[model samples]
Target: MDNLTLVIALAAVAVAGILFFINRRPARQTAVETVSHRRYAGAHREQARPAADADPQTRFVETSKPKQYRLLNSSEQELYHRLCEAMPNMRVFTQVGVSQLALARGRQEAMRLSRMAGRGVDFVVCDADFSIVAAIELAWPTTGQEIDNAEDVKRVALQSLGIPMIVFRPNKLPDADTISREIADAILRRNRLEAERS
Candidate 1:
């Protein structure tokens, strides 16, 4: 091959290597939730294991508490933070990447989390309400199914996976004020329940 052709081939290989690392890295620890009950049991044990700061902060908003768990645009985080604080003693972890399924060594991360849900996790938190609001205001489409169908899809997904989904919405969202409060409250509830000593 010519020098330019050789350079292009090297670049292609480098790009491929990077993609593989990203997809396969972290060694799929999160995906272990899909494989065995034992694995999920282990994960629950592990997930519940205290971080250095896992004391009073571990108390989560109960799952019954209303909250939407949708992902938000950057501009909305501050408002959401305030709303989260508005709840009595809520500490929220908002860093979840939509594409990042906590798993280990498998293509079936969703399945792992599905099983994990059965083990202990009662709710899946995604702030889908804003996405819905954004869809309505900007007329963008995020769901593969129609909104009603999409709602069913979401409900069914969690049911089959054995978890309730709490989609937290932005409090300052100009549209859909009613739904946003509902979703936020649901999420806040779950955040409180996770580490509560029964």
Candidate 2:
């Protein structure tokens, strides 16, 4: 066959192969991305633990001490407000602790917030996502000798880094002055410890 005929035949075969592959791919057969219900706290939480009973969270009750104020909401009472703040950012991360990423994120943020407790033992408000919020408030004495050790551990590594750190959670806070104080204190301590070690 002449070179022109050979070239034309090869082109035809190539075109046929392309068409065959395209036809084989059915658009309807495409994979569907399913959003898991695990993303919601009320639904997934009950299934996760029948005994823990987030019903206790029904009341946004406060456990006050001379040193700290912690609000408890196991039922996700605080979720509506907190979750809205996360939109376009980490909004999809509702019902923290249900997912590993949420837990990790909360711990990291809490580290910087640990500082404010010393300046003023105001309430440390965290949504139900951070169970520690309850512990910090109810567990500690509000007035005397109260130290936030949880935030301390979060910065154990920073003990040698001396990085100036700060924790800031945007959007509505249960109480601004108190929460900011906690965040600042935590960050300052982390910075101080790191400076001392370094």
Candidate 3:
């Protein structure tokens, strides 16, 4: 081969070898990235495949049912309105999940919290800055022991987080003034208890 042609052939081979090594080299990934890649890879492969025709029986049937308008019952609605009026300075939220108020520390605590997380309080009272002041449950005459146990668990969970839970009988819901006073009293008591503990 001529000198120039021989040099050109060597250069082409060298370029090919460089490209081969670059393609073969594994990209560096962090522990989190590695796990994420594995998960994503599996999902991507499954998604790439064509989906099977869904069975008619298994498919969802269309319904004429209308969307629900009112979230709370009549008595609950009355209390919700009263709370809004009473706590004008503070924000009042209805049907708040237990998990929103407190956080779990460890795996075991997270498991414990999972049960209570699904359970929600009737109302949550928050300060101007949105810090949780207390949880409120309207006392309704309940039949089942299971419900009572669940409420007890919810109460204990809130209490552990230094949140006071106020129960009010639906028939005897206090006036706005009484509600304001009671909330303030509950907050003071909770602060005092925490102070004593610390």
Candidate 4:
């Protein structure tokens, strides 16, 4: 072959080889990328799938229903009835919430009152004008530090508001007349204290 022709042939072969290499490399890279994408998608689907043995019917969902009982127990019921009977003129509310009886004037007081929200007096005696006259708690024979502390807090709060609190022992089971007398006396004493203060 002639020298120029040989040189041309070699250059053509080199260009063809270069093009082949470039095209082949991209095809391999594309295959590798496709495989990686499929693997990632599969892993994601696996993670999202629920357990093989999981049952839809067995899934736990929280639910609630209305309470089906009186607020006071049998002993409390008896006392509540007696209080109601004794105070025919006064409005006697059973299981009176502390929040309903007292209001918080500040953030700290609100938080404190919130803690005492669940704790309440057995009966709340209100006058004809619907103003709270006193809060009565029926005390059992049981004694505990927590109970004593709660009672003390309640007593102080009621006293500060010029509302009297009368504690009666369930075991003693005082008569209706005695109960009425005690309530009357408390109301009179509270009135006298306010009169003196003013």
Candidate 5:
């Protein structure tokens, strides 16, 4: 071949080699990456899967029914019956959530209220119209430190909402008449305070 043809042929061969190298390098790298990814994925699956011979009982299974129990103890039951008898016209709800009794003004207040979701009054007294009259907490004669702290938090939250909370010790169970009178008085006082605000 002439010098120009020979140069062109050499150039073409170099270009082909360069292209082949470039393409082959990425293909090899990709193949390695694919193999590594598969291995990593297999390891993750092995870790996530239970052993083939694992016990059926050892596996976690959700139940349609959750564990059930009585909401109140014997003493609480006695107090609940008495309160019901005392206010025949009113509705007495057991384990009433504090959120139901209080109104949140904004998102911040609502989130704060959500934290109080599980904390509830032992008994909630409502009028015939379902307007909350007052909240009653059965304070045991012997209260644990944790219980006392929780009660204090509940008291503060109720007070902030302008709701009256009546704590009664089982040892000193008040007469139905006395409870009814106190509830009536509290309702009147609350009405007066709300009226003044308006």
Candidate 6:
């Protein structure tokens, strides 16, 4: 054979040898993976899907039943009534969001607004002109210290925007007369502070 023929034959032989080696090698086995409870639940749910052609048991039955719940519990309801009685001249709103009373400003407006949006006052007292006066938080007798700390954070955030937070324990609620006086005092104190700052 010519030199070119010899080179071609040698190349063909090398290619065949590589193919034979590849065919004779044992197939690699992938390790068995351990599935966690969470993952197994997800996989089982995926595998247990009903067939498309299978009949649905309750084709005409309505499964979603939504029920209404009271916005305030018994303690909160009592406080709401007391607030209304004490501040009859003013408007009292329940479950009020902090964002409604204070707006975020400056460079971090969105971030600040989001933080305020997540926090809310149990009750809000507003003047005749609809300006917010004070925020009231009713601390339940059975609450933990974490709730108290969270309330403190809310108080500081509201105070920063010139709004005062009044905390009243449900079990130790003051009478209407006392409540009215406390609100007046808080408003007066806030005004004095603002005047001094100005």
* CA lDDT scores, all candidates in order: 0.44, 0.39, 0.79, 0.79, 0.80, 0.77
lDDT by residue (1-198, candidate 1, tens digit) is 599999999999999999999988656755664567787778886775556665776654345455766666554555454435443333334433222322321346565445334222112233433211111111133455566465445444433322235433333343345545755654454344423412
lDDT tens per residue, model 4, 1-198 = 699999999999999999999999999999999999999989986776667688977654334674568788877888878887888888887887676565623455446567667777888888888877888898875678887988899887766556789998888877799989999898986796557546
Residue-wise lDDT of candidate 5 within 52-152, one digit each (tens)? 78898795555668776888988889999889888899999898778766643346555667768877889988889987777899887555888788888
Q: Which one is best on TM-score?
A: 6
Candidate structures ordered by lDDT, highest first: 5, 4, 3, 6, 1, 2
Q: How well does candidate 5 match the true structure in TM-score terms? A: 0.56
Task: TM-score winner between 1 and 2, please give it.
Answer: 1
Candidate 3 residue pairs that clash: none
lDDT by residue for model 2 (57-165), tens:
6644434544444343432334334333432222122222212322243565445444432322112233345322211211222333335465444334223233222
RMSD of each: 24.6, 15.4, 11.7, 20.9, 16.1, 17.4
Whole-model alpha-carbon lDDT for candidate 6: 0.77
TM-score per candidate, chains pooled: 0.27, 0.23, 0.57, 0.57, 0.56, 0.58
- Runs off by more than 4 Å, candidate 2: 1-174
- Which of 3 and 5 is the better model by TM-score? 3
The TM-score ranking, best first, is 6, 3, 4, 5, 1, 2
Runs of candidate 5 exceeding 4 Å displacement: 1-68, 103-109, 142-147, 192-198
Give one digit per residue, the lDDT tens place, for model 6 in 103-178: 5223454356567676788988888987767889998654688877888788977776667888899789888998
Local error of candidate 3 at 130, Å? 1.1
